[model samples]
Target: MPLLDPARWRLLHGGEAAAVEPATGEALGTFTLAAPSDVEEAALTAARAQRAWATAPYSERAAVLRRAGDLIRRHEPEIGEWIVRESGSIRGKADFEIRTASEECYEAAALAHRPLGQVLPSTAPRLSYTSRIPAGVVGVITPFNAPLVLAARSVAPALALGNAVVLKPDPRTAVCGGHALAAVFAEAGLPEGLLRVLPGGAETGRALVEDPRVRVVSFTGSTRAGRAVGELAARHLKRAHLELGGNSAFVVLEDADLDAAMSTAAWASFFHQGQVCMTAGRHLVHSSRYDEYVERLAAKADSLTVGDPYREQVHLGPVIDRGHLDRIDELVRGSAAAGVRIAAGGRYRDLFYRPTVLADAGPGSVGASPAYGREVFGPVAPVRAFDTLDEAVALAGDSGYGLALGIVTRDTARALDLADRVPAGLVHINDQTVNDEPIAPFGGLGDSGTGSRFGGEANLDAFTETRWTTVRATPAAYPF
Candidate 1:
């Protein structure tokens, strides 16, 4: 049986919005367009089940997460297919998402065995300590670009830490992101009602945030939307962990290996059709090597193939949908109008947009180009030249976003210096910006987010609350 057999799920009746293959526009399946009432029901359900889950033995919680990881590996073929078709990811990228999601489960499993609290020194014949407790129900809102991994990163840790999750997956990727996870956890022996999959839009998300039962809201999406979610969560006094938008920079120094820099730059900007939040939106190359770098990068972009992942061997797949494709085109057109040279591609066939490179987008001209100035969530690389180290740092740090930054240089000292000067959360010395590991603290600063900082020990803080307790062997003398 298919993993997302809608009949086996608790789907609401008479809901609109069907999941479709973005490249082909074929109807894959329809998920319940969760209404506000549904969000209330899910939040209530999660709250009711959370007490027992929080009290469950550490071994039991760890076993559930380990089994979920195993089950995901066992069902890789089906899950990968769902991601490729539903989310418009290339075959290899689907595999990457599958692996990352599986790793997330494994990482979260470790959270159960870690030290939960600290023993503090006491002045008298008493003991003082701090214990961690679940934050109760957590609401997770994931976007369509990389649904499975994004959801898993938060969901797995939230569950392992003993908080129930109410997941609000993007309707465009509901099947792979929502139903697939629910099915895995169920088969892995997770208790019923601990995980609620609500696939929906802004209304559903707002409802989830507003639900009093949800103590925390973990959101991953555009910066604009993230701000709105953050505001709502704050008004309701809920902790919001936002992993938002980014216009990351890829810096290439004069002393860097040209071949390696060019290859890595292409991968950084064009990976997953550059729909990633950490996609290298700006290319900062030293003026001495700028011309050569743009030429090689544009050639590489031109050579990449774009099509339906299921049908061909393509490096890039279509954008999520037509609206996204049109937005990308508008940015590229505006960049061209602002005198940014379209060195390679600035076109598309249906939703399959060609990997594009915009050259000569310097500081003076970039202000007028939306592609360079904002987070254009598409496969458009805007290259700018910098003459000095200070200029490069200035260019990189000037953006309101500080998600990820990459510096390619043979001089380790220079690379380290640049990394220090930049305010991004993740920095790579000799590599590109689009990267993630379950063990690393993943987040950003400024408009990017309010520091989601999800992964490893950070998950403990994000999902649980700490309380101080003091004990005495005998009753202490009371002073009324």
Candidate 2:
């Protein structure tokens, strides 16, 4: 009950709670962690709500979404601060998140009027038609990093598809996420129970995913948690969307402008202190420009000031919490022990790890070693130099995870070549792959994630499914 304490907003749903400290594995805050029985009650309430919600016309549903987006835009400054404080993302990073969230909401709202399907010209005297239909209810479990963007990406699509949504935000960032979203929709005159914001941790997520009423579970986070959610959803034969981990690489070819590469790397890996799943945690450069690139990158990286997220001069911020600081430290020491040159940084202050970079991060280099294979989930990138494009691509593909990758090059053919060879879902040329607009699809492949490409027109597929009802116009022939 301690985890459920109402220290913040009364969790969107009902429950008793307690405050506890996860950092020291002791109670630091009063919070109510969801219990199984409470979860069941919430699920029942959601199911009953969906029955009424599913009947609402798409146009009417879209109105609220449009207004919600409008409200978000009007309060960008306030919402931006919420994101920065909760995620510890820098001001620029937080602004980007807000923009991404707003854009996605607009697109989702517009989708309600878009054509769904075409009527086929039939040879026989019969009518044939197909169209997208809401999945009834969708469960969205968001991550702490860029909470608003991720939440919007999931919720917008479901709402556009006309599926009622129960958004469960990350406990760490819930203060602004679910509560703010709930406010926006309420302002838009959304029907009660149509779009709810429920905030909590593991138990809350588990309950939402396992609820039979939930038709789809859209999750973005670690592979371990995704797998657990997937298994649980599978037990009920439900559909699940998982956007998992990544250790994306930024590959700078010999022809790439060193300045541009450094700029891209600095933003990609350190923008949010490298908490983004698509952040370029690994930097692989061609040997010809490798030394020059790293020097420029280190210079630029070192110049970045880490301070309060709301400060304009600050390019970096705290690493979410102290646990992350320790994790970044482990990467530094482990890689150093592996004979990696600390290169740019391997120090820290409080929960902040100095803007760090590792070089000579070969297969054996401490930070570049196998230990850093998966998503580091922080702002510590290791530089790995290669002689050929083949070698660079190989290093980028070496990890089990494949979400996104970046390539800085001047040659058109070379960029395409690398994009073709890379295993990531999204690849960027001459810029950091982490740079994205909600208009474009973003997801992952392999261990990075297991979800359909979402965003744009295709996003409707994630929230709505297709079902064909065939009626033979002609009399049944023998065995027809």
Give the whole-model CA lDDT for all candidates, comma-separated: 0.91, 0.75
How do the residues 1-480 of candidate 2 rate in per-residue lDDT, one tens digit apiece? 111223345543445443222222333234344454555665566667766666777778678778888888777777776666666777777778777777888888888887877677776666766777788888889888778888888888787777778888776777456666766666778777666666677887888887778889889889899989989998989888888988888888888877556777888888678888888878888888878877887887788887765544677777766766787787678777877787776777776667877777776433446435646777777888899878887888888788888888899788888889979888888889686677787789988888466789758778887765445757656664
What tens-digit string does per-residue lDDT give for candidate 1 at 99-188?
999999999999998898999998888899999999999999999999899999999999999999999999899989989999999999
RMSD of 1: 1.3
Which residue runs of candidate 1 sit more than 4 Å off their true CA positions? 365-367, 474-479
By TM-score, how accurate is candidate 1? Answer: 0.98
> TM-score of each candidate?
0.98, 0.90
Worst 10 residues of 1 by lDDT: 7-16
Worst lDDT window (10 residues) for model 2? 19-28
Candidate 2 lDDT for residue 419: 84
> All candidates: CA RMSD in angstroms?
1.3, 4.0
Clash count per candidate: 0, 30
